[model samples]
Target: MHVLLISQYFLPETGGTTNRVASLAKGLQSKGHDVVVITAKPSHPEGVIWEGYQDDGLVRDEQEGIPTVHTWVYADFEKTLFTRLCSYLSFMCSSVLGAVRERGSFDVILAFSPPLFVGLAGWITARLLNAEFVFDVRDLWPDLAVAMNELNGPVKIGLARWLEHFLYHRADAITAATDGFCESITSITGPDTPVQRVMNGTEPEVFRRDEAGKKLRKEGGFDDRFVVTYAGNIGICQGLDHILEAADRLAEDRSGVLFRFVGSGPVKDDLQREAKRRGLDNVEFHPRVSLDEAAAHMAAADALLVPLADHEIYRSFIPSKLFDSMAAGRPVLLSVDGEARSILEDAEAGRYYPAEDGQELASNIRWMLDHPEACTEMGENGRNYARTHCTREAQAERMTAFLEELIG
Candidate 1:
């Protein structure tokens, strides 16, 4: 099968969306399919074009064996609604143009979403190519925007809904990354529309302990601390203020517990300001690192922190960083409710703290710090669970098979 995948973010810009698309492309190639990934020229989270992707033409490259085509997009820090919308629009326009350039070569087209405009590109490309259009729901778009209060008012919400439904109704198949997403998409597309829950996968090899990582941790002064690390987007959705509050409260009670935030996003400055205002010396902040570096930090930590805002809609969402933490054998201190919480509980991988509750989070930090043996056991459990059920290769194979069946 020839597959066309549209993702706004891809390799050279590491994160869940990039990782997932890259993994699937590799898996499809391994299974004897010609997969073409159309993405923006490697600028994300930070908004600076990555090295070598600065060429103004439609830059193309091959990773492992999969062919990737890159195109133009507005690469800027999405600090405001105007900037974000321009970035999204630019990517959407460029992705569609790139996909159209090689339109008729694919049997089926799949588009991942967040900047939902990629789905529009997929729809257009599929139509031109006379191919099946597959909408891969990484997160329910404008809904997440609305949930974060990022998109308000009837005019904006209605427009978002209209576009969302447009893609939902036109898709040949919808593959959701979560069961909750599957349910949500199903609610709109109705019972007849095909929706599959193809959850995110973890890379176990990268997350394991390593000597270089150990050296790096010692260099970072993490060797003496019982670190609780959060290594991902420092955004509004993360609700990181809770982590800061927890750090403030546990300053004296659990002086050994250090909250290390190792990532960057729009909310990062605000978070740092709040942390300073509260005079929280136990909290440390680091700029976002490469995927390997993130895993190393997680492996060095005694526990990993995953938090989501206290919004009801977020319950359906599970950030990909959690799987990385679990694979690293770091006991999780989860501040989430819903599918993510259920997964943690079922795996018995970590302890949960009530979301946005600083006191509960502080208590859990103390518990983990005090119960070293128990945390170690939980880490082992998490490693086993991740290895058994979430290996990227295995899940990628499943996704490929699903796509094959859908195309057939």
Candidate 2:
């Protein structure tokens, strides 16, 4: 089968969405399916485009040896609704043009969504090429926006919902990344549309514990302290201010535990300011790094932190970072509820603290510090569970079966 994978984010842009799509592309190619990708150049969490691909009309390239096309996007990282929509719409228009430029026919066009317009691009491309369309829902958009308070007023939200509904109904099949997403999509589309859960996973070989992280540990003077790290987009959804609160509490106790944040996002400056205001010296922030560097940082950590905003919509979110932490052979300091909590509990990889509860997070951190042997055992359990249940290779095979069924 020939596949065309469309996503706004891709390699050179480090994030969960990019990794998931890249993993899917590699998995499909390994199964002997011809795969291609259509994406924007590397610009994300930050609005600036990466250096090498700056001169762009429509750049053609090979990613992981898969034929790929890079289209133009209005790179805006601002929080305003208008700028955000402009970014999504620009990509939607350019991706369709990029698809037209490509030569071969596609059996399936798999599009990832969050900005939502990418699904429109894929649907348009599928119609033009006479191919089946598979809409991949990493998160429910307008609903999440509403829950996050990013979208308000009935008119704007109503229109977004209409667009989401149109895309779902047009798809030949809809694949959700979480079970909650599947149920929600099914509820919206009714029994007529097929909604399947594909899930997000990590590549264990890429994320496993390694000696390379010792460099970061030594350089950061973390060799003697217990380092708890959060490496990903430092965006609003992360609710990272709570981590600072926890750091402040630990500072009072002189717990010898360090909180590290390694990433960039819209809210990072605010978090930094808050930490400085609180005079929390135990917390440190680093700019984002390449995937290899990120894994190394994960390896250097005594425990990995996975946090989310306290809201109803987030209960369904199983952060890709959680899987990475598990694969890195590190115990997790989780601040989430529902589905993500279930994964941690089932794997016995970590302990959960209530979302936005800094006191509890600090208490959990202290517990880990006091019981080093238990933390080591928990880390081992997480690594073993990830190896057995959630490797990217297994996820790819599951996706292959879904796509093949859709094509048939």
| Over 4 Å off, model 1 | none
Give the candidate number with the greatest TM-score: 2
Q: Give model 2's TM-score versus the native structure.
A: 0.97
RMSD of each: 1.4, 1.2
Task: Tell me model 1's lDDT, rounded to 2 decimals.
Answer: 0.86
lDDT of 1 by residue, 1-408 (tens): 999999988886888888888899999989899889999998777778888888888998886566889999887876677788888899888888888886447888999897788899889888988889999998888989998888999998999999999999999899988999998899899988889888887989888965656787789876888888899888888888888878888888778788888988998998889889998899889989988888888877888888888888888987787787889997898888899999898889999887788889888888777788999899999999999988888878988998889877
lDDT of 2 by residue, 301-378 (tens): 999999998988899889988898999999998987889999999999999998889999999998998899999999
* C-alpha lDDT of all candidate models, in order: 0.86, 0.88
Residue 250, candidate 2: C-alpha displacement in angstroms: 0.9
Listed per model in order, the count of residue pairs whose N, CA or C atoms clash below 3 Å is 0, 0
Give the total clashing residue pairs for model 1. Answer: 0
lDDT of 2 at 17: 81
lDDT at residue 138 of model 1 (Cα atoms) = 86
